[model samples]
Target: ILSDETDPNRLHDLKDTLDRYQVYDSAQIDELVGLYLSGADRDQLDPILDACVAAYNVGLDEDGQVDFKGKAKAFARTYAFVASILP
Candidate 1:
């Protein structure tokens, strides 16, 4: 995720990937970019992101476990609102 990366450019790259994959809408991507650029600590965002993954995982049976798509969707849905309001 963008939070773990040191380079800001990687966040932009991720936004591109998200848009290209249709994982999130334009508004969600804007929120994500704002969050990353807001100087919030990665430590703060990590657990929230992790929780999104875990919540999504609960819907999956033991045989199937995947993080990328589900996690991204969850993150966008959950975090986007908060990110939009942040300075």
Candidate 2:
């Protein structure tokens, strides 16, 4: 899904999935943004920033905490996955 989704509609679907699963948190989203911004070049940063914002826009809870317990672990795993792929 990640590799094939190159447009806003597909990305929005992915964000909806994350929201439905309640599998990520604000802090995790912030960390993802930080990771992308830290290493991405100017050209690569835009999409990463957009993805981060979209993910957070859908996934963050009203209280600003993770919606589901233990989902932070999933966020950590996702972070590691992205980190490994990044330069």
Query: Highest lDDT among the candidates is held by which one?
Result: 2
Global CA lDDT computed for model 2: 0.55
Clashing pairs in 1: none
After superposition, candidate 1 runs with Cα above 4 Å error: 1-33, 62-87
Per-residue lDDT of 79 in model 1 = 56
Clashes of each: 0, 0
Tens-digit lDDT track of model 1 for 1-87? 434524444445545654554333566446556777897688755655565456447744553344346545645644564466457
lDDT of 2 by residue, 2-59 (tens): 3543343443444555566544456666766876868956565565557656656676
lDDT of 1 at 87: 75
**Model 2 lowest lDDT segment of ten:** 1-10
Model 1 / residue 79 / CA error / Å: 20
Instruction: State the number of backbone clashes in model 1.
Output: 0
Instruction: Give the runs in model 2 whose Cα sits over 4 Å from its true position.
Output: 1-7, 39-87
